[model samples]
Target: MIGKWLDIGPTTQIEPGSARTLPVFGGEEIAVFHTVRGEFYALVNKCPHKAGPLSQGIIHGDSVTCPLHNWRISLRTGEALGEDKGCTPTIPLKIDGGRIFLLREAVVA
Candidate 1:
């Protein structure tokens, strides 16, 4: 389950295969990605390893290759791929009426 949903902006604000980082309260940042398949995903902007900016990573399918170390991360689950270790935090997201909404609570375990 998720907590209060906050509207980020219209879906059009983020192009497919691209990402946008939004700074939230408490100095934390969230990375919102629009996949080529038109799906939206939200996760912590920082990578679990080295704290790299995931928003600048390359989007491939439902995953992103971290720019700092090429660590592939699942956009849907925020899990590190292959032999990589650790996982980033994922935020629940929903799209309605062409607008994007993010759950205020972190969905990570």
Candidate 2:
């Protein structure tokens, strides 16, 4: 089924080169980041290494270095930067009229 877009907050809620964590329906958190290059990406906030909150991480280029262990993961593709075969899931995001929207049906693995 298709899900509707959820208004997260104003686009300014997440600045360029910064990230924000939004609460979801099932006790899960979603991390939304806007790269310094002005691209929006979303993914599950939990890191696969030690279950760290990825939203609290720092953005370096197109990758986010996990705050807990410094594990770098790609925000665009949800894949670990290096040395990992597994990856978290990415969510669908849309921006319109300076507001950020997140799709409710975020897929994870």
Question: Which prediction has the highest lDDT against the true structure?
Answer: 1
Candidate 2 regions with alpha-carbon error over 4 angstroms: 1-3, 107-109
Worst 10 residues of 1 by lDDT: 100-109
Model 2's alpha-carbon lDDT is: 0.84
Candidate 1 per-residue lDDT, tens place, 1-109, comes to: 4447788899999999999999887788899999999999999998888889999999999999999999999998999999999799898999989999987655322
- Tell me the deviation in Å of residue 62 in model 2: 1.1
Question: Model 2: what TM-score?
Answer: 0.87
TM-score per prediction, in order, is 0.92, 0.87
Cα lDDT tens digits for candidate 2, 7-100: 7788887789998887777788888999998889999898878878988899998899989989999998888888865587889888889888
- How many clashes (backbone N, Cα, C below 3 Å) per candidate? 0, 0
For model 2, state the Cα shift of residue 107 in Å. Answer: 8.7
Candidate 2 clash pair list: none
Model 2 residue 69 CA deviation (Å) reads 1.3
